[model samples]
Target: MSTYKLRQGRTMKSPLVNLAVRRLAIALVTLLIVAFAIFFATQMLPGDVAEILLGQAATPEAVAGLRQAMHLDQPAFLRFIYWLGNLFTGDLGTSYVNNMPIAELIGGRLMNSLKLAGVTALISVPIALTLGITAAIMRGTFYDRLVSILTISVISVPEFMVATMAVIVFAVYLGWLPALSMANEVTSITGLLKAFAMPVITLSFVISAQMIRMTRAAVIETLDTPYIEMALLKGASRSRMVIRHALPNALGPIVNAVALSLSYLLGGVIIVETIFNYPGIAKLMLDAVATRDLPLIQACAMIFCLAYLLLITIADLVAIVSNPRLR
Candidate 1:
């Protein structure tokens, strides 16, 4: 028995490790592609960093000086290689807008985005899971129908619209929540939560909505499987039959959806972040684009891409590991 168990463990371990390595390799290659695209595309844009700096007032001499300073005169291929090399050496350079290092500018705002994402994940995941379970267990009943209708509505609504409506309702009409503010002034988590209420709700709505439908489907599907029917026939309580039997199998879909939910939550939440004027990477990227801040834009883009990839990868691995069928 011990030897058999060991062999089984080895089999699982080997496949899992190989899968992780393959995913990691794919992700690394993907990162390179993304980086190259960002570098070349930004370089190929009509306006140079100097134009961004001097605005419409730039002259031949000023543009030349600025271009020289920014090394924009370099050949495109050299510029690409230089950009990639600098990235490897931890050099993101200074923002043309503020003259501050891109990293420093991003550092402050990144924290805010992280906090918002964290709060969102903490709130939405459980709510979504719970609602999903309820819908699944109550399949064919009014409860299931009601949740399905609501989730579809929520999912269909764009996050920006939700953000706008939430602000109007909560901030304008109710006067219960603040609109468009998460400045450096939030000194405590309590204050942060209060300020973040509407944004959080808006961010979580679609995500939780997606979760609801997926969860319902996953659970319902699992319940219909023959093994679950057998468990039910054994006189398992409703809760036990669902939780112990159906939920494990159902969780695969739920996990996959949750992972995608988080992936979309990355740069995809830019709309919500923009509506709220939340100074996360989304807003940061927006600002960079408006000002044509090359370094800042590239840095922000890379950060967002890497974050999205990492979140999706982690979610995929978690989903795979948590599901017996996949394992």
Candidate 2:
């Protein structure tokens, strides 16, 4: 009997392991497709790297020499092969303008973006969840209506517009926080909070709105189930019924929503970062594009794509674990 039980355990575990491997393989294929798309898209952009580097007055001979030196004269297919090889070896290539290593340029910028995303998520998720759960609990009440109206309103506004208004209200008019976040300003924890204040708020408000709506919907659906109704009749208080019965069942969708929101927060901070002059990956990519730095652009875009893919895979795994039918 013990041997049979051990066999059953292994049987169940093996499928999960196999599923994870399959998902990883799919993610790798998706990344390869995305890398190819990025490479070609940048290659198609209407400017010459050689001309950008040498200025408009450069002679054709000089431009030809520069393109040759930069390996831009190679056929697109051959260049892609070379780039892919370097990518596997962690060589993201050098910048066209400054000639700096791509990895060195993005290293600090990537960390800055991660820090911003982390702080925004830390501040946003709990509050959004709480508000959503509360709105669910108080459905049809004035409070619930208020929360719904507010979240909907925020959702209707664009991030850049919200960011502009936040700056006007908080930094320009009130002068309570700095208008622009500077690296040196974030020396201490308090300083970090203050520096991150505007950008974080700008990002969190937009992100949390979606979370609130999704959470409310999921919780409300769970509350309507027969199990919750029976629990209520069995002397379960509202809080007790929600905590013990409804929440557990509602968790699958909530986890999926959180994961989706987190992924958005990671990649969707571009407008917010641009508006506030935050020195994050988004800003780095924007500057790279302005200068037609193809290698750096490719690296930045590839990083974002990979991050988004990983987040989605994690969400899928979490959803499957929360509701085993997905397996």
Query: Which is the leading candidate under lDDT?
Result: 2
TM-scores for the candidates: 0.91, 0.92
Model 1 lDDT per residue over 147-250, tens place: 99999999889887888899889899998878976656789987777778877899899788987787778778888889988988899999999778887776
- Please give the lDDT score at residue 288 for candidate 2: 89
Off by over 4 Å in 2: 188-190, 233-236, 324-327
Worst 10 residues of 2 by lDDT: 318-327
Cα lDDT of model 2 by residue, 153-177, tens digit? 9999989899999999999899888
Cα lDDT over the full model 1? 0.83
Number of the predicted model whose TM-score against the real structure is largest:
2
C-alpha lDDT of all candidate models, in order: 0.83, 0.89
Q: Model 1 segments beyond 4 Å from truth?
A: 1-8, 187-190, 325-327
Cα lDDT, model 1, residue 218? 75
